[model samples]
Target: MKDSFVAEDLMDLALANLAWFDGEDAGDDSGLGCNRDYRDLRGKTWADVRRVLECERRLVADFRAGEWVPDEPGDGPEVEDLELGVASVVTALSALGCIPFTSCNGRAFGGEHDADALIVGFYARPKHWRKLVDLGRGSRTELQVWDGALWLQARTTEDMLRWAERAVERAGPSASHPSLM
Candidate 1:
């Protein structure tokens, strides 16, 4: 039988995976220093949004490219550790501004997925969960802003990618925020 997992359990597992990243040490004040908010249908400034998206892109690229392989010589965690690592990767990606709505479906309460796993990995507190959920809500065109909540529609992946790219462009750094790195 499959082990039933609660949202909180998944969140805890995800957070544990990101423990090495020191997201808590980032000192980002917007609920999720790295986690973003996407409630306004009009969207946020590009500069602010790109930093988060860049983080997402890097994480996804790493995962898809198989660059996160555990160290050899039995230094890696066991099977359970691998599971948690996957969960953490998912959480971190979501926290850094990718969408995971495809995975949650109706399991979420009030059509809201538990983004606590993602948010906690990016920020220091749990309250940022709402912002992460809002970001996911805005990622899809199928989901519309009606009345004051998200409504489902026939959206496509291209639309979401376009939106994410636009958000990144707007959020990308300007001449003012020079990168020391």
Candidate 2:
């Protein structure tokens, strides 16, 4: 809902993600230990991905146009389905084709290991994994590869959302950036 930049960038990223959906295999060995095999993304057809992307695009467009409303259920993973305070971050990651698998807005009063912190897990190519590593430097974000996927953790929901908003703003040229996937 910030501006057209985020929407346009998201649309561009969606296109890029679709283009690279089942295309050439991105070489691994970037030292990030990311799983380029994408076993977690198995069973997802092109149509499924497209539906999600299209839904995201429409939602972004609506938000950009100042339309304040919640996404209807059963219409694919809409922004409303995401945990509060982490929707922006998750959407940005999804737009970038990171293939988000899990996320938590974190609970300060909950009995969980991630209490008072934000967490997001996604699958990415080596190049995208490198971008995340570079972005996390000197920041509160923590990057880890576990269970053949990449995870990002931040101290608070605010920090996580801020980091992800930055990513959305910078994802304009990332559709084909040499340093990004």
Candidate 3:
């Protein structure tokens, strides 16, 4: 696949998967409440998490080989034929140095109002949460940070990309940052 997949697409897929798991229609239910279980936000069933991770691996391999294709039935190839396309996409992003953070870790911090900063924790003896007030700058939208879980109310690819860019920037050179493998 071309290295042209945007961060928005990846975020969409992630949100879709999350929605499916929650027994909600991707179109009707937004992924806003996906991270409600803050204590174990990333604490998905081992099998489910493994599936996502596996998909990431395949996505990376396909991207590296320049053979990755979208799974749009009639429009393109099917994901079933691609072997872990979902996971592959995630892996590819991480490989490209997109940071991956979860509520389980200290990467996210919560607060209220626009003055509230969306902080991302870094790696150190006492991990720190960097303020990301500028990420939501010029937008009326409020980036939600609930008990260490961070998620933006984005519905389009552009919105997601903007959020992801800010997230990657916030993650910095920490090991949590995505790596190109």
Candidate 4:
């Protein structure tokens, strides 16, 4: 990435991503399209944005450099069942400090999608997503992204466990600024 900065340039695209999570733009200049600057950074200085961007850059660089190590898997609850339910999935993931805000057992036989599947939604700051992806969680994760959130869909609890294990292998043992859920 180029190290240039302009008023119209993205003052840390990572920080702009967190705007939705934090309820503030922090002087972000990611203007809306259509030949106009629509971001609400008109009167604000770029000091805060620069600070955030610098921090995010450092973290991302460090994660990319493998300065962090994945967290242990035994921290999560034991998953011994083949037949899984929403509660079981939630409990297992919560043990890893990743709590899903929305989920479905995919067992809506009389409703939506098919049964025998699990779908869960969760969010994290952009850098954290980088950490996981760095450790190779991209395949299990759906390509569609919303508010820095990700989806994990599996045909069975075992499949979910495999994906979860991959995430655990990537999650660092400690983070100076742990990603917000």
Candidate 5:
């Protein structure tokens, strides 16, 4: 059985993951004060990361608002500033109350998968559990269980986009902000 979790829990988890990098060094010069390893985030807080990444504030707000319009271009996080292809998937998952900790656009160093695949690591709420199962079953990609989270692998950027679309559809209308209920 899938464990139940609330949107607040996911928000806290995302915040914690961003906070975890506050103390580390860049390790390499990838220009964002952080290397490809996600260290030395320019500013101290997740808020800084969001700003530097040019993340659309409304998307983050939508996570809590529990309402999102998928594939609306500017409605989601800015992909150009994100780690390539996984941004859409991550944004979709976040809208569905999932906390993504890691992701890759399937570059040469992307672990396990080929250089063309896209992957994301996240924690999902129980309410969205069935959708995950359905995605894994219907897609040409792979969704695997990890120690404390889940990993999704898609063969191409379009595949990930399709997965995101399906997820939002399966979830139907988003619920209200967690605090409102």
Candidate 6:
């Protein structure tokens, strides 16, 4: 369950996340010192992203090569939750300039094939839940945003996006301003 996004845009999206973090700390306008932290960390952040991407490529290649040792301790959903799916989604969303406050695509503790939910903390508009339901996407995409931030538990990426399109639209343009995170 991944969303399409431009890798080059990740830096800006990261800045957006940092800015949101700033908003949480200083009740003094997010615009004040938002970009400062980002400017200083850009190079390091870029390098980190590159390193992770390279390692991910290697991991995938190893798996494809049938060299994935099943004897590894955490080679199950619990680890996948951290090492793959969640990381991938986080990165994808970051590229879109929408940072999740916190999230979890639930996993059965030991690869029991019982993984059964997805959680996302996003920013959305009022009455957006109704719109999602009307779109028929809410049946699988649960939404709650009563207190300025949207929290969701979508069953599928498709379902998530169906509601997100409307939510983002209602929030207005500027991808960096897309989240309350």
Using lDDT, give the best candidate's number. 2
lDDT of 2 by residue, 13-112 (tens): 3222321233233222222223332223323333333344445555555544657344443222334466544556555665555666567656521334
Q: Is candidate 1 or candidate 4 better by lDDT?
A: 4
Query: Which residue pairs in candidate 4 collide?
Result: none
Q: In model 5, how large is the Cα lDDT of residue 93? A: 57
User: With candidate 4 superimposed using the best TM-score fit, by how many Å does residue 126's alpha carbon deviate from the native?
Assistant: 0.9
Reference-based lDDT, residue 54, model 3: 47
What are the RMSD figures for all models against the true structure? Answer: 14.8, 11.9, 15.1, 17.2, 12.4, 12.1
If ranked by TM-score, best first, what sequence of candidates would result?
2, 5, 4, 6, 1, 3
lDDT to native, each model? 0.30, 0.49, 0.30, 0.37, 0.48, 0.38
Model 1 C-alpha lDDT per residue in residues 1-181, reported as the tens digit of each score: 1122123322433332221212333333343322353111111233433444455455445644777554543233212121211223223333334322212112111223333221112222233333333434434323222222222221232233333453333334452231211
For model 4, residues 1-181, the per-residue Cα lDDT tens digits are 1222122232234534541223343234343221133232222112322233334334434534767433542122112211222333333333333334455556421124334356665444444444434322333333224555554455543444444444433433332222222
The order by descending lDDT is 2, 5, 6, 4, 3, 1
TM-scores of the models, in the order given: 0.29, 0.49, 0.26, 0.37, 0.47, 0.35
Q: Count the backbone clashes (under 3 Å) in each candidate.
A: 6, 0, 11, 0, 0, 0
Q: Model 3: number of clashes? A: 11
Highest TM-score model number: 2
Per-residue lDDT tens digits of candidate 3, residues 62-151? 645759544542233223232222222222233333222321111111212221222221111101112333444432223443333334
| Whole-model alpha-carbon lDDT for candidate 2 | 0.49
Candidate 2 residue runs with Cα over 4 Å from true position: 1-79, 108-116, 173-181
The C-alpha stretches of model 5 lying farther than 4 A from their native spots are 1-80, 108-116, 171-181
lDDT of 1 at 166: 39
On residues 1-181, what C-alpha lDDT tens digit does candidate 6 reach at each position? 2232222322232222222333444333333232221211111122233334445445545655767744544353222233332333333333334434455545411232224655555332332333433433333455444334444555653444344344434334444332332
